[model samples]
Target chain A: MSGRHSKHDLETTPDDKLLRKLEAKWEDSPTRVLRWHKGLDVRGLDCNSAPGWDGDKDDGGALVAAHAEELSELQERLFADGRSGGSRSVLLVLQGLDTSGKGGIVRHVVGLVDPQGVQHRAFGVPTAEEASHGYLWRIRNALPRPGYIGVFDRSHYEQVLVVRVEGLEPEETWRAHYDEINAFEAEVAAAGTTIVKVALIVSKDEQKARLTERLERPDKYWKYNPGDLTTRARFGDYLDAYQELFEKTSTDVAPWHVVPADKKWYSRLAVTELLLGALRSLDLGWPPADFDVEEQQRLLAET
Target chain B: MSGRHSKHDLETTPDDKLLRKLEAKWEDSPTRVLRWHKGLDVRGLDCNSAPGWDGDKDDGGALVAAHAEELSELQERLFADGRSGGSRSVLLVLQGLDTSGKGGIVRHVVGLVDPQGVQHRAFGVPTAEEASHGYLWRIRNALPRPGYIGVFDRSHYEQVLVVRVEGLEPEETWRAHYDEINAFEAEVAAAGTTIVKVALIVSKDEQKARLTERLERPDKYWKYNPGDLTTRARFGDYLDAYQELFEKTSTDVAPWHVVPADKKWYSRLAVTELLLGALRSLDLGWPPADFDVEEQQRLLAET
Candidate 1:
């Protein structure tokens, strides 16, 4: 947890008040709190550390539960704004290794809002059709519509990360993608979409434990893939690739937030707070009625 | 409320046990509990009544909350089944008049499960491109992938309801759609998708109150459409259209469940019960591990 704030301070600031305070802190930099910046050592970062969050799992779960109503309210406002001729939307990009708690974050955090307002897409190994198109083609197609909160579970960053680590593309081809990704994100941001890119960092030991649990449980077998072990063998390489990804693709329009995800509850809380900051930045208000309320009331009463 | 089952009977059966009892009742006819049969008069049915649910709003709300965990678990099993090479899926089609609490059912009932396992699509007035294609073209594209709970807010029935009432198409063109929709639904069901088609029935007087509430609240203004008034003016004609719709399109494969939607809580509970029945019919258990668990455990240990 950050030293600037204590657990007592968080306990005092609850619900909307806490959200507003965090929004102010976020406005100071947005990246100043939980972001992965240039030259930061990704390997050295503690996966269990809950940066800017001073609480245990039980407290974090309670905090998340408390934020649900407000989160739902804000999402409804966003949906209403879009329906009433507003073009602004939000896009949350989640990037992580297997067992880094990406699915958990989607279930616990994004699940706080109405699913009607959410557009969720999980990118995997490209299909033959997708591989035929330019890398950004499918990504552009999946951008959130106006007034929506879009969540991409394992998104376009796989182009630079997996493609680079696995040598799926030529060196020159994958190397040129960072600048292209940045430009693409800038374009999306300029088109009134707020993009929040997140990297969930989990330690190798934690991932092994999780994988062992998955293997042990029959119900969890569907989630396990043998290929995950291949990826696990190259953990250091993936981290190195992620290090360069942050150095290049993190931008003012869409910065990357590296969430320590060994503690599932903390990661969920951090993502929830980051999403709150993103929605609050929009400063949206309930759209005023477009019709003549008195006339409509009279008409409805007569009917 | 049905006389066959008293409030005491419902109180004794709770959670999965309640779900099982209802599933048995559902298997007896599936429509015996809530079906809108041929001789049933649409206008005469009590909109505020809670059929088969002998409980107050508080009790209904509590029941829905209690079912949440089991609902989530069943959905996960369905998802895992799909991921493990199963072809089964469930489609929940929501059709209703304006302010009939379609959105409320979605927010309160369907919101109980993980959104990732659900695919939600809302069909409205067709765009220029959509109008050019055959009516079912867009609908076919929106069917749930294997292992998903697909929800449609307003569906293909709009072809018969609004199109016929509004005279958007020729008499021959719109009338032919009933058989076409049945054929479409039968084909979808034959492909291993259990279809739960719901018609939320709200009385005209209740609708007037709901629309008036929308008009009164600024936050709800976006939901109010001038065209909704135009539709309400022809409410009788629309009911006649729906009467013919139920008589023609309701089939063994995808029967229509007419939910009394005047009481929002009752409607939510009824829809939740219907969805529970649909998922339970699949009778899915956790997919067994395909790999040697002990070997994988050893491999994970090495990692």
Candidate 2:
């Protein structure tokens, strides 16, 4: 069949024939959505998978599982080094909508890493004291010290997201935060602190589905906040604001990745990739051997 | 029951009630034996009830459980304060025998604190790379930044304890470490970091009981090392060294608390009291109200 004819055939077939669909996508890799970064218009890049771009979800899951393991190993090695040297450190920021899988993503990323070296922080509504300080104050205090990896569940972006949506601040003040955030991230980057920011963007429909699941399961009731539905009512506004802010703020110093959060598996995969990409940027190594043999012998004899 | 007869009865009884026993030894406080201080005579403190004071323990379980709840509460309050403030921090150091409840203490301390503001690190044997650096380099790096509470499971004391025990360094070198540690801790204290040091001491009999349990449970086999038995065999010498070290090392700057490890409940309670004393010293308070009328109006408008 001609290339054009094969492409046409793919468009009408049922998706269960995923192997055939993937083959066609690979054949058309140069023009496919998965490889759609050629133009580099990050804004225009169609993150959504079309007929050909959609492949085996299981493959995606497997890829995530594999990469997560690899990343976890790297994270552990980094942690071991940091704990001993006690100098360099890392901070991972997870910014995603509800059910974008912040908690799950953290579990996978640091699953194999030593819990000793990794710190997890979940940012909720600011307390009255947190509000007394600048928006970044609470977050600034939460950054990890040397030789550790700090993970933020919902980070300082609440300044731009919730505070903005809630009209907690004047338009002029909150609008200025994009630059302020960019500056803050740049400062952390300069401090030998590596910051990996991930924005999990699930579709409005997916969010509603997750909310419904929470309502149906008694175990998930703690996660169900009636306030979230009120926020759901303004979902479109939140998305528009988030998209604009993300576009304006993603930078070379601290780039932000908008992961396709509709599928938890895919979200996990993209996040692992992002984390590996960030950590790989750092050239870390194991500590060298330097015990004094005679001294060690003497100490052993004393024992 | 004449007073003189009752006092004579108490003197002859081997085991008094827990609180009374503790009070009887309050001024002497053998728990202080585990602490780093000057003037302790480990060899002299050797007795059946004071087994941990002379390195005669195979288990420290009861000592660990004794202080779990209070330590748990203090950790919780520390993290809560951290969440409220944008910049404040604390550090908890656990140093003890091979099975002196370091791991158990870490688990209990961090159990209730939010994973975000609290980071736990267990420092063990130096790697090839770590041995090349100054002894305290690795530990210095793990200090939590502002608004964090970093727990060190083993910590820098290995220089004085294990290193000295193993004769890894000259007497001059290990002896010098006490002052070095003092200076280092003073600096941390000056930096608004509240440092709590706990040493778990278990009687040899108790240690043997725990070792037996570890052997009986397949899952705990990994925790038992044949080398520790050798250390136990030379227990008297180790105790003498520890006692001398603790007596000379414990100072007004950073006082050491030698917690009895035979009864987990008693040990846990002592740790709780210590933490409560430390945190209570900080004078933490809720942030004053900060929302202005306009901000309240915005919230009202949304409502």
Q: Of the candidates shown, which would achieve the greatest DockQ relative to the real structure?
A: 1
Interface RMSD of each: 1.1, 9.9
**Tens-digit lDDT string for candidate 2 (B1-303):** 011232225465432354244334334434343454454454443323442322222222333333333343444445445544535577777776766666555434444334544667778788888889998888888898776777888888878877887798999999999889899989887877888777677777677776666554433444556577777776666776667557666667677766666665446545645565566576654333232434433433453
TM-scores of the candidates in the order shown: 0.92, 0.51
Per-chain TM-score (chain B), model 2: 0.74
B1-303 in candidate 1: lDDT tens per residue? 021232225465445575454434333433467877778878788998877765577777777776676688889989999988899999999998999988887887888888889899999888898889999989999999999999999999999999999999999999999989999999999998999989998999999988988887776888998888999999999888888898998898998888888888878878888898888789998888777778777777887
Task: Give the per-residue lDDT of model 2 (tens digit) for A1-303.
Answer: 011232235465443255343334332321122221222343333334322334456765654554444454455446545645545677888877777678767655554344565777788888899979997998988888776778889988887888888898898998899999999999988887887777677776677677666555433444455566678778767876777767767777776666666767666656655566666667664443233334433433443
True contacts kept of each: 0.66, 0.07
Off by over 4 Å in 2: A1-57, A60-73, A83-87, A289-303, B1-95, B98-303
Candidate 1 lDDT over A1-303, as tens digits, reads: 011132324455444565554434332433467887766788898997877655567767777776676677778889999999999999999999999989988888988888889999989889999999998999999999999999999988999989999999999999999999989999999999999999999999899989988887676888898888999999999999998899898898888898888999878888987897888788898888788889888888888
- Steric clash pairs (candidate 1): none
Off by over 4 Å in 1: A1-31, B1-31
